[model samples]
Target: MGGGWIFAVIVVGLIVAALWAFTKGTPTGRQAGSGSGSSDEVAQLRKNLRVKALGNDALVNRLVQAERNRMPGASEAACYKAAIESWERDNR
Candidate 1:
């Protein structure tokens, strides 16, 4: 009975810790700020890759425009990578 209470308390403590972490985003190497914007860029990149993989020229054009709008300063290497990935996916 005592063990069960201890286990319950441990579980509750873990739950509270998880909630706290969720509310307070985990710290990373990036500066104190720049969390949300970086995450948004990553999310946009993921969406761009998926859309590019669909292998429609019109859609690809739209992806390019959307990406430029999202991050005009983004590297050309990223664009090349998306194209290569799309070609590979389409070929496969």
Candidate 2:
């Protein structure tokens, strides 16, 4: 009976270890950019945008132009609004 209990505990311990290992494992380089499963593209994009907005005039111009292109009626006020929205979304 004691041997059976020891075996059961070992099995449970192995199962838990396997679960932790799988959950904490890193992906391969190709899998990193696959665009759907477990990717960090959105987070990276947000980080890039924030850095650009904070430090680069060229990037800020490009971002503003992109926003204006997407919303033809977007005024300077609208651009500011969109920028604030983007900032809030990322910060939160």
Which candidate number would show the highest lDDT if scored against the true structure? Answer: 2
Clashes in predicted model 1? 0
- In candidate 2, stretches whose alpha carbon ends up further than 4 angstroms from where it belongs are 1-52
Which lDDT values do the candidates have, in the order given? 0.52, 0.53
Candidate number with greatest TM-score: 2
Q: What TM-score, computed on C-alpha atoms, does each candidate reach? A: 0.32, 0.35
Residue 82, candidate 2: how far off, in angstroms? 0.6
- What would the per-residue lDDT of candidate 2 be over residues 1-92, giving only the tens digit for each residue? 89999999999999999886643333211223333423253333434455636867576666656766778875554553355455446566
* Model 2, C-alpha of 92: deviation from truth (Å): 4.7
Worst 10 residues of 1 by lDDT: 23-32
Tell me how many clashing residue pairs each candidate has.
0, 0
Candidate 2, residue 35: the lDDT equals 37
The list of candidate 1 runs beyond 4 A from truth reads 27-92
What C-alpha lDDT, on a 0 to 100 scale, does residue 78 get in candidate 2? Answer: 50
